[model samples]
Target: MDKRGRRRTLSEHVILDAALALLAEGGADAVTVRGIAARVGVAPNAVYTYFPDKAAVVRGLAEHLLGRVNHDRFTDPSQPWRDRVRALALELRAELLAHPGSVHLMLGHPPDGPHTRAVRETLLATLADAGLGPADAADASYLVNVHILGSVAFEVAAPPGGPDVGTTRFRWGLDRLLDGLAAHVATGPPR
Candidate 1:
């Protein structure tokens, strides 16, 4: 306000949007504090007011993106555990693939926001409902998350001109994982 006589204001959402734009334009390395500040028409130092550092900005962007995931599907009490897990996994995979530029960024820093937590909690609950013990449920949820993130990263890294394989590969892998989980549940806890 002193230098340009204009109001000095920056919202977290605005900063995150600009950062995301920078990310899309290049990659993770493109989304620097200076880059985001320039995009927002503010001094580089101004960005610090909203984000302490570049990592915070990246995390903000991740949260903003993950916030778009529809978790209501995980809330249905009547849905079978397998169906619920598969539905959520497929939806997450599609969402990640839609933002190809972000798949890599997300792999390093998984979402820890409230919405992300809700998704994780729901998955844990589904596993518990499937008769997994508390420890097993926690382990299973971690495995599912890893599979989704790892699969998306793999698909995004494929050659740009390669044939579109749809999701047969993903579905096949997911089915095998679910089969294993089913078998594990059927056997009860190890003696």
Candidate 2:
């Protein structure tokens, strides 16, 4: 409602941006519908007009962040498949690290959104191209995704005493995982 007797206007993008800002400022707990509406200068119920509930808003924010991942770097065919996979992981890790407050909200969430789906597809395809069968590729992709999520969550939550030890650890862990995948491919899995 306004002086002109019109209801306050609120777009999905505006609501999502406000929610993301709240998430960046105070983690997932701060992105309530009421809070978003207030941030957008609308009545509390106005946010619901776009997002059904707070969970929906959180999902939107996570998807929004995932959508911003640099997929091009991972899809470049000129690079070795392993390097492509590693670039994807690093880019995703960098994004998650950039928003430490939002890591908790995103860590265990399903990758059903479009952007997350794209990343998943690319990862699986890369593994498949590197000689992994369908089952192996799917399994490996899931493991990689889980590793990135868990690793980033721990790095974000770690006590502020280390001088970026997580970076080395991440590279080491990633290389080990890739090595395991390479070995599996080389050994051709027992028939």
Best by TM-score: 2
- Candidate 2 at residue 16, lDDT? 79
TM-scores, one per candidate: 0.89, 0.90
Off by over 4 Å in 2: 1-8, 162-165, 189-191
Q: For candidate 2, which ten residues in a row score worst on lDDT?
A: 103-112
**Displacement of the residue 67 alpha carbon in candidate 1, Å:** 1.0
Q: Which residue ranges in model 1 land beyond 4 Å of their true spot? A: 1-5, 163-166
* lDDT at 28, model 2: 70
CA lDDT, every model vs. true structure: 0.81, 0.82
Give per-residue CA lDDT, model 2, range 24-90, as digits (tens). Answer: 7887778788888889888888778787877777788888888889686687666788999998999
